[model samples]
Target: MDLQSIKDPSFLKKMNNEELEALSADVRKFLVEKLSITGGHIGPNLGVVELTIALHKEFNSPKDKILWDVGHQSYVHKILTGRAGEFDTLKKFKGLCGFPKMAESEHDVWETGHSSTSLSGAMGMAAARDLKKENNYVLPVIGDGALTGGMALEALNHIGSAKTDMIVILNDNEMSIAPNVGALHTVLGRLRTAGKYNWVKDELEYLLKRIPAVGGKVAATAERIKDSLKYLLVSGIFFEELGFTYLGPVDGHNYEELFENFRYAKKTKGPVLLHVITKKGKGYTPAETDKIGTWHGTGPYKVETGAFVKTPASAPAWSSLVSETVRRLAREDERIVAITPAMPVGSKLEGFASEFPERMYDVGIAEQHAATFAAGMATQNMKPFLAIYSTFLQRAYDQVVHDICRQNLNVFIGIDRAGLVGADGETHQGVFDIAFMRHIPNMVLMMPKDENEGQHMVNTALKYDDGPIAMRFPRGNGWGVPMDEDLKQIPIGTWDVLKEGTDAVILTFGTTIPMALEAAEILQKQGYSIKVVNARFIKPLDEKMLHELFSAKLPVLTIEEAVLQGGFGSYVLEFAHDHGYQNIIDRMGIPDHFIEHGSVERLLEEIGMTTEDTVAKLKSITPKKQKRA
Candidate 1:
């Protein structure tokens, strides 16, 4: 079948199971081909092909709302909802989003990029439906890994207690980005293996019922035995006890089984938990064999061989540099330990974990718990290095402020992907960390000019004992600068002057430093003397240096790859106002809007953070007298 001919999933209802199976194959083939060019959540979408097909066949979307938790697995849903045509530009700017986007189609009822939010969304929709006196199904497909999240558990508790009419499709793929951890995973594991127990219980009950003349005390004993067996056999009784009608560990790939369970769930009263098991990368050989989540999401890959199109890095990845440095420090400092919120691989902490297994902790999608756990470790005088993504760190804001910052615990927060992370788009962008982290007291926020400075910053953060310190680095490779022979500690709240001039000063840090330098160089050729300084520390503002710049009466341009509000530039403006300095200052950064997925260069250019923009801003702020001279 021509997949593009699918305008909506209404046609799916008319097709037989055999046709649906063929459609699933075609969909998988299309995804494998298209995603190989555009790159996306290939493994996840492949896993959900049949499940999504079964869903479309079972329920009407838009009318019957279906929410995808984390939404990366919504690719198949997108395809079924007549979006196969947009695969060529998947994850590109203004193209097909990797996750569910409501604007893209009416069928996409809810947008999600963050994990563990679907249950709450589904409950809201269900409540709305009930209030409006409408009859429609509300199903939230959530994974076992997402179930580990505190919010998902909270939503589950509330939904079960409220007795809201909704079907919770527990898509158990046994992995979320990485292998799931925590006790919840263990529960799901037991449930995954409970198929045999279910069969045994069914056989036992059948035999018990067949026995003739069974009555009174013997019947009561048999009933008690059956109940005991049920309690022993069914692993989902925990969900049942929570007031949900728990259904099978159904085969997610089997259309008939999925359709049957889904139909049963829709008819059931109150809330129903339809536990369905799926393989993460069901069809593709390389993705199917993915043990470490490399196939969870990916860049473009060769279709025939499954080899990723390689662009050899000119420098080391920032994550590796920070994690390796931390590992090195852990060897010398026994007090040092590592922690991540289910991102050990992303944060490049696998090396650290392998070397110091006892000291490494992947807290499994619980950012709040991870933050507090680090704080607890810090209270015992242990140096806890909490490596987390900049976006995810938002989830632990209260913990960072109330626990770590308030107590002035020595927690080294390695804020990986601290700027505009491309491809994954707005929800995954790290642009808000500066605005969020800078406001907290005892929080020292800093970025580095390059990999060399990044390592030093990591060293400085681990060495600092006064309060919680954060060293943020952007995604991808560094500038390939040579490393120092010996690790040295950089002074806190100090800025580095990369280029010296008198007419104007360009203050920037991290990924934007090169742009600032290039802009300054451009201004120099145009007869404008511009100074470039790496304002590495976002907070603390290098008061001494600010005083010098103000005293010199030089115009300043602050550039950051972060949000403009309450960001580094705002701090600079605040500093000038506090000191009663009349220095002219201009800020260049991401505007007060969400940036979409694209290449980093394209994103930078889109937001006008390029060298040309920087140069223009600096030229505008150049001292009038100096310009006239």
Candidate 2:
């Protein structure tokens, strides 16, 4: 029988074991073909086909809320939940979202893109269910890597203590975007491989229960023995001791096993931990062989060969520039050491990892620990470079404020992906780093116009060991600008005047610098002389420059690729408000609403971040000043 013939939702309930196996294979095949064109999380989706199938079969969604951690693995869930038709437009503009979308379907109860959040979301839903007298299962499928996050652990602690009626399907793929790290990962690893010893131990305990009145005493003793042996056999008694009902190391790929475990979990109550073991790339050879988690997300690729169709740009990515620059500096300076919270490959620290393996720290998904650890390193006079994504660094805000900034440690934070990250959407946007980082005391916040400036900023941070320093750079390639030969360190609280004009000024930084320059050129063409200033230091505003511009009676238009609320615009406004400047001031950037997935160019244009928009808006604002003829 054709697998596609089984169309009804009820058909999944009646599917025999063999038919289920065939269906899983068909789903994998369909995913490979569909994702080749659309280009999504192919490897993760392939890994979770059986788990997703089993989940839908066991629990009714929309009524029974299911939260997918990170949501990258939800392609299988989406395909099964009546979203298969829209899969062709995955991650495309106004099309199917790569992650779970609450707007997309009723089945997707909670929208998620970041990791380690589903558990907390699940807890909240479960609490609401109790309060509302709703009878439904809330299953949160969190990966092992997500479990390492402090929030996930905190959620786990709450669930364990609250004794909420829920099931947490621990999707152990031994990875989370990158390979898993930390003590928790080691514990899960031990549990995944503890099948043999656990089985033998269980059989012995079962036999011991056959004894008489002494059987009760023997069983109690056996329970203790089993608990001790569990700790001895595996590294993870951590979950069990925390008050979760540990279930399995069951094969997630096997439909029968996954279905059986899920069925059992559905019946069980009070936070059942169903540990399902899955491979990151289950069927695809290339993904299976990939160890660095490159296949976690990708653009279009050849299905048969698993080769990426388009080549990466000849220009080095911002990540590569930071990594290469830092690696070079670290090699020369013994104080420089690199640190990341499980983002070695994404941050392009592979070269640093190879050259300075001892100096590099992959602290898993524990961003808090990574920050504090860096702070501790700083205490020892070692220049710890905590290289993290701008969004991800938000996870360590408390640590930054409390641990490092509070103590005034000399920790260098290389905040990568620091602007409007395109396809990943709002949750991944690095926009608020400046706003957040600038607010902190004893923190030097800087953004570079190009790769050359990025390199110099690294040197600047290295040389300036007075306090904590943060330098942010946007995602994707630089404008192919060559580096300075002397590597002269730019002074703190300084702005570079790219285009010297008298009428108006376009104050900007990083990726927006090029656009600002373009806007200035457009204005210059139309008889509007506009000055373009690269506002390098975001925190300590260039007061001298601002005073000079205000004295000259030039209108200032503050532009950025970040959000308008609490952004560079707000900073400029606050500065002007304090200084009492009478000249006209305007702010331009992404609006307060969450931006959707699209190309950076497309999204920028749509958000009125282009040179044309700036020029038009500036012309409309100035209006030739209405000079009397």
Backbone clash count for every predicted candidate, in the order shown: 0, 0
lDDT of 1 by residue, 1-629 (tens): 99888899999879999998898899899999998988889988899999998988889888989999999999989988899888888888778888888889999998898898999999999999999999999989999888899999899899999999999999999999998898889988998888733245445767777778757666557757866876877865778778787778899999988887777776778998998999998999999999988999998899999999979998999999999999998899999999998888899988999999999999898999999999999999999999999999999999999999999999999999889889999899999999988989999989989999888888898899898999889899999999997889988999988999999998889898888888877778778888899998888789999899999999988989999998999999999999899999999988999999888889888888888888788878885433333
Q: Report the number of the highest-lDDT candidate.
A: 1
Q: Show the colliding residue pairs in model 2.
A: none
Candidate with best TM-score: 1
RMSD of 2: 2.7
User: In model 1, what is the error at residue 617, expressed in angstroms?
Assistant: 0.8
- Poorest stretch of ten by lDDT in candidate 2: 1-10
Model 1 clashing residue pairs (backbone): none
- Could you tell me every candidate's TM-score relative to the true structure? 0.95, 0.94
